[model samples]
Target: MLASLRQERILAAVRLHGAVRVADLVDELDVSDMTIRRDITELARAGLVRRVHGGAVGPDTGSRPAHEPGFEAKRSWATAEKQAIARLALTLVEPGQAIALSAGTTTHLLAHLVAADAALRPLTVVTNSLAAAEALHAAVTPAGLDVILTGGVRTPSDALVGPVADASLAQLRVDTAFLGVHGLDGDGLTTPNLLEAATDRALLAGAAHVVVLADHTKWGVVGLARIAPLDEVDTLVSDTQLTAEARRALDPLVGRVLLAPPDDPTPEPPLDPGAP
Candidate 1:
């Protein structure tokens, strides 16, 4: 079977069973134990599954995904890049700031990074995503922080939308916000769903500074709604895999663009907004 198909099956298996054994996957797919281990590792890397000793559990339902990705399919690619981006994003948050996080895999990673930090305490986190809210809730409440989740119609992407989320966002303001989206371009941010677009726009409007966390793949692909005009974003953070064309396209629009090197520790400075 093709890798995609096999991975999808593995996701399905995990979803159906809650978790799946490595040996079962090996026997079902006729792959070696090592191969199954590799597959499970990939899925775990994707944030789609939680691998235990001999099997993988389903992704945390409080977040995204309409259906479960099988254990083997959870880690499909870009694991390192996404994690790296997440780490960079964590650097943007400070202690005692009320921050909003958008709904997406990259932002989801950001949520985990924030949770993992021991020094930060009592964060006021607001989100319209169930997954993000869950992650932040788990991270903050134990540390005696407050987390507010917008209530609305829940979508397959794990976002809460409709009139409630919009109204709730308008009622509050935040210091900084981390936005996640389906795509980004010279024009603005885009998403496949119109409702999601509206929710993201609301979050942007409510924040003092908006930092977008999109991976390289999101640079050009078009989606249904535009969240903001290009110039509106305060900062754009992406992995080093971003192409020259994308960098050029982004440079003129955003205030500061932070390109995170996956390997280098000497971090690059934000690209000048005015420099050509």
Candidate 2:
């Protein structure tokens, strides 16, 4: 392929995936690693992309606000990865424990999983997502589940954030906080909305353990406002697609990194009729 055509293909992949690894690009473009690296360097110098540890990210166009995608829109971005992360996050919760969930598609999926699990009932859930509250409310069945919705101004992403939400979080503490963020870089977890950042900080303060739920796509991206540094995170749950460089960078900063397995669509086993 011509040099210009290969570069264009690289840029297209980066834009489609938000981030692209060198190995993946090599396989996609059927080019040598050195070739890919040279192309990426040229693109970065041209201000069309930003090169990171293992890959390149599309340059911020400054046209749209960072991390401003609507909740519904994000639901389809990484469906399988979000589902896998949510499943892993559920393992961190125990019955009778109080957990706080920050507003985001991953946490919203967690809320749904928590509601579906009959064994993890009789728990308290505090959240700033109206969607999460409704899911939890409807899923209550054999066990009692308390859902607390923080009242505040709603953002375009469907997150409730403001003085009211911050004040509410200040007055309460929980066993864990499962947060969803816009981006995760060497600096820390971040979001584009300033008010949401404040509210997220409050959520962190009110929890004994802070667990961040982010997909691989979020890596290397930085948002407008900083929430907290990577060291502040007690745990980070992400899908296996996360790069090795990300693991190395996060290992020292985060207390633990749990990579959820890839989503497999195998059917569940049948119950034992006589075992019970």
Model 1 residue 264 lDDT score: 44
Worst 10 residues of 2 by lDDT: 267-276
Off by over 4 Å in 2: 1-4, 9-46, 49-67, 141-143, 264-276
Writing each residue's lDDT as its tens digit, candidate 1 over 35-133 gives: 666677687789777554346666663123333232223223355666678778888898888999876666766776676676667678888877666
Cα error, candidate 1, residue 65 (Å):
13
lDDT of each: 0.72, 0.82
Q: After superposition, how far is residue 269 of candidate 1 from its true place, in Å?
A: 25
Q: What's model 1's lDDT at 84?
A: 74
TM-scores, all models, native as reference: 0.68, 0.79
Over 1-276, each residue of candidate 2 has an lDDT whose tens digit, in order, gives 988999999899888888777767888889976688779879988989975534677787421444366676566566678888988888899998999999987888888788878788789999998777766877665557888899999886788999999999999999999999988988999887889999999999999999999988778666677999999999999989788888999999999999999854632222122210
Model 2 TM: 0.79
